[model samples]
Target: MAYQQPALPYADNALEPHISAKTIGFHYGKHHAAYVNNYNNLVAGTPFDSMSIEEVICATAGDAQKIGVFNNGAQAWNHSFYWNCLSANGGGKPSGELAAKIDGDFGSFDKFVEELKAAAATQFGSGWAWLVLDNGTLKVVKTGNAQTPLTSGQTPLLCVDVWEHAYYLDYQNRRPDYVAATIENLLNWTFAEENYQSAK
Candidate 1:
């Protein structure tokens, strides 16, 4: 099972106005594909080659000999999920079960936004910010380059990539602006809700 790049859930232009098509094109096409390719090559002819991408990532994550594979595989999976976390029509507050969970865990939806933004903004370097479910409780997590909550056995409900490649084209050096806009306008709460429920 060689790692294969998943197609974007929507067209590159589908996220336009918030995230430009050109940005998505390069991010998904060049950056993400390179990771997938690297993962496949690194694991070629190894036992890990037959494992699913997620399985390989989890299995090799702590093995020093497989560090490169773990990084590439996890990064490939993370990028795929991150792209799906946005939509042109997405954004706004979450509703229903996800909304209830946010209120239950974060005191209120607004507080959740504040904390999420803070996490994304203060990550200090290239990484990711995520809303993850751990034992049915929601929490904000920050991961360094290629790291993922999956490595720690948490279920990621929604995520924003803070890697420079993700926003450099559209947001330039303004990562905070990108984070604010993403949380306010491009979040796919429906997808987050689905992931939240499924994690149970």
Candidate 2:
């Protein structure tokens, strides 16, 4: 089956002020769509064609001969996950079990934010910052290029795309501002909580 780009959870303009519709138009409509198209084209007649995106990612990851497959498949999956990680009504501290886990694991929600922001800001190039479950503990991690936690045996609970196209049109070169705004005004805690619960 051909891989398809998933629909954005909200309308293109929904995340306005913090994230412009123009950015989503290019990032999701163009870049992410390109990855999905590339992945489908690359695997159309291969054994990987029948695999799910995650399966393709795992099968091709770190295999030099399958780098194209890995990069496109992983980026496709990553962008889909990234869109869901944002919300028009998101942001603020989480409540319930996820909140308790964050506090317990990071010492406090504030500290968790610090770690996540640091990870997102310090990622040296095109990559992602993630809040993942590693051995039942919540942790912040960053992956360069098309790398993802799925390849590292970790379950990603949330992610923020730090690739320039993700924020450049709106924030210019101020990546940290974009990262902070996303965390403060757009992160979908409900989605993270659901991911955390499902993993457990």
Candidate 2, residue 157: how far the Cα is off, in Å? 0.5
| TM-score of predicted structure 2 | 0.99
Which residue pairs in candidate 2 collide?
Answer: none
lDDT of 1 at 125: 87
Query: What is the C-alpha local distance difference test score of candidate 2?
Result: 0.96
**lDDT score of residue 36 within candidate 1:** 90
Give me the displacement of residue 158 in model 2, in angstroms.
0.4
> RMSD of candidate 1 to the true fold?
1.0
CA error at residue 137 for candidate 2, angstroms: 0.6
RMSD, one per candidate, in order:
1.0, 0.5
Which 10-residue span in candidate 1 carries the lowest summed lDDT? 1-10
